[model samples]
Target: MEFSGNPALYRRIAIAVTLYINGGAFIIFALIKYLLHGDTWVLGWKPVLVTLLFSLWFGRAMYRWMMRLDAQYGRGSGWVLESVRVKLPELRPRQPR
Candidate 1:
């Protein structure tokens, strides 16, 4: 889950997993249809295209949502691209005399 620390990696994995599950399920439907009958429109290029498009839209929304989450719980009250540039430093504990 720490891999999600990197926004790019997190987004990529999220999108990949989403599309993979949807795509795999669609493929299974197509295969089952083919096995049961001969051919069907349930599985084809259109489904894949539509899924990809939906995945893109989902990714965009997720990105925005994650940004907002980071803003709310991470730094300040709002989300800004500039936030990425500023790194928060960890404070070290002083020795107790």
Candidate 2:
């Protein structure tokens, strides 16, 4: 659950969070629009396309920001990068006959 130092993990988490947040925001906006305009925009392609574009732009921005912060503070601190070592199978090099 803790992705503190791993840039890959952090990026993935950031993307997921951004998607959820943007989706929720769009849903709320749609609800408000529905209440005000009575579904007029809901059936329109323009609104849907605009919302999709906005969400993609916002998500990309958020992802970049999160990665920058992780690199600057999280990984730089040497704490988030702390990880446990796991034992793995040992391999021996083959000798030339």
State which candidate has the highest lDDT.
2
Predicted candidate 1 versus true structure: per-residue lDDT over 4-97, tens digit per residue: 4467765776677767866777778888888888776756788768877877787777765665555534454555565356679999999999
Best by TM-score: 2
- Segments in model 2 whose C-alpha atoms lie over 4 Å from true places: 1-3, 35-37, 72-97
| 56 Cα displacement, candidate 1 (Å) | 1.9
Overall local distance difference test of candidate 1 = 0.68
Model 2: how far residue 2 lies from native, Å: 7.9
- For model 2, residues 47-80, the per-residue Cα lDDT tens digits are 7787778877877777667766656554444545
TM-score of each prediction: 0.52, 0.54
Clashing pairs in 2: none
